[model samples]
Target: MEKNIQTKYWVVDGKEPDPGIIRQAGEIIRNGGLVAFPTETVYGLGASALDDNAVEGIFRAKGRPQDNPLIVHVADMDRVWELVSGVPARAAGLMEKFWPGPLTVILRDGGVAAKKVTAGLDTLALRMPDHPVALALIRAAGVPVAAPSANLSGRPSPTTAEHVRNDLSGRLDAILDGGPAGLGVESTVVDLSGETPVLLRPGGITPGQIESVTGRILLDPSLEPGAVIPGKPRSPGMKYRHYAPAAPLVLVEGTPSRVTGIVRQMLEENLLRGKRVGVLCREENAGLYPGAAVVGAGAGGEPGETASKLYAALRRLDQLGVDLILAEGVEPRGVGLAVANRLRRAAGKIINTGQLHE
Candidate 1:
């Protein structure tokens, strides 16, 4: 993989992407090569969805599992149906409202996607990203692009172009540097192959919003702590533990005050043991941990801010060389639920503030 490394790195103005540069990345995808480009959510490792060999390169580049599946990004509804058997009525409504945004829908297989893209299942996940560079590449390639987060399989998902470089610099044919992603998290993945739509993953689009558009949607049981996901997962974030950082992490969940107390106690205890600890908390809670390296999750009480800063905060803590990270969990409501989900998976352990500290 190292021998064929290209010097083709390109940067877009974010306002007006260079058509020529985007076409270059598109050609790579068209010819079965990998390109990492920024999306509104996170940077994505993209390949032509219709090309079996190209899509396989995406799994290999990210060290992603074949059975885990990948989301196909398109430029429009026509491209969407070209890859799926047909979009369900509910899915069509979602696409109408959320296409060109951060939502991925899984529909019945049309057999147009590579077998490996769907993990040989009868369904494939699809989305149309709202990022300029991403859309440009997809349109230039003139084929649906299948992408996973542009990071190593289990590591923190890359939200900036630098993060992608840090993880996949030499592996891809080119990387479109379009500044930091807007969402800083992955898309909401909803499975629509069944009678009632099931939310396979909580993301930028909340369950409440989906319910409003498609009526009541079911939540996969595996989304809860200690519940096993039944059968093969039809969505990307369902199959594995992900968004982990290098240092061991523990999630602290409770009311703001209780969370602060728990984090304060843990930081002190770990500091007494001479462990260099990092606290990922909100701006107001920074003063609680006097001796630990503190990385802010968000400002005010806005979970959108926290969701945007979550991965970057984890990466910053890692850069500070902390031995352990103790994070204050966001409330399990709205986009906050998705933020909490990523934090819990990133953490090897979870501590409810009401529980006694070990």
Candidate 2:
């Protein structure tokens, strides 16, 4: 991280980012300075995709590994074409359907983006964010922006400008505060640079939703819980432990009743040990845990709701200064897959009640 650098902060309307403020932010990017801005999914630490030095700054600011690639954000199809070697028919179809949303399509690099952005890979990930502020800032910059989640590496991804400020206050050049991100997770990454379209990382866009567009896509093996990733990661969040909070987190998975039972037992054990315990659970079960610092992530265990509130809940628990956090796992379906993936990666340990015998 850069030392003692001052960060400029600005609050703007999410629906309509002030042109003047966006222009100023854009100028910072044009000059190879880092800027943290909001996307529909999460806030991104952005720099010019074409500038290697600027792209390197993103890695430096977040302490991110250079081997994990960054996503390039563009405002329009023209810019997308300028950066990718070719858009396959399936990719084109996906772009038509999911562009300007929480989907990232990886294609063969056209050799236009900075080498640092692709992390020396032959492919590049690109997406058009579905937020007015993101679009406006990219348009104002007049260059493709290479970005990764704005928070410090391995922390929960920022869902609001305040989260960005908390993690990256003095490390970056500017922050365009466009309110809270609509989705609490990062974009869904689809790798089309291969023979078969592969889901590199699940996010707000679900497997069912992507398969609806591109016939049955393959989930990357790395998506499996506790699986090891070989070589470099083709996309962000694939090779590293991400979305973790300062406190150690333990995730419990099984039938809701079983998980609830296990978490309650663990919570009691921790409290007895004189440790502060925090519980991340569904809204319906908020009252079940006593004495522990409990946070309800979503209502009725709804996938979308859980995802949109997951990071905030984690950050909140950390703020409450819990010594340990116990998160309840959601079903790995729809957006819940993304939520579960993040929790698995964030957790220091995972207990599957199904794997435990009475």
**Taking the tens digit of each residue's C-alpha lDDT, what string does model 2 give over 1-358?**
5567899999999998789999999999999999999999999999999999999899999998879899999999999888989999999999899988999999999999999999989999999999999999998998999999999999999999999999999999999999988888899999999788999999988888888888989999999888889899899988889999999999998788899999999999999999999999989999999999999999755889899999999999999999999988888888888998999989899888773112
TM-score per candidate, chains pooled: 0.96, 0.98
Model 1 C-alpha lDDT per residue in residues 87-175, reported as the tens digit of each score: 77889999889888999998898998888899978998989999888898999998899999999899999998899888887778888
* Candidate 2 ranges with C-alpha deviation above 4 Å: 355-358
Q: Which one is best on lDDT?
A: 2
CA error at residue 72 for candidate 1, angstroms: 0.1
Cα RMSD (angstroms) for every candidate in the order listed? 2.3, 1.8
How many pairs of residues collide in model 2? 0
> What overall lDDT goes with each candidate model?
0.86, 0.92
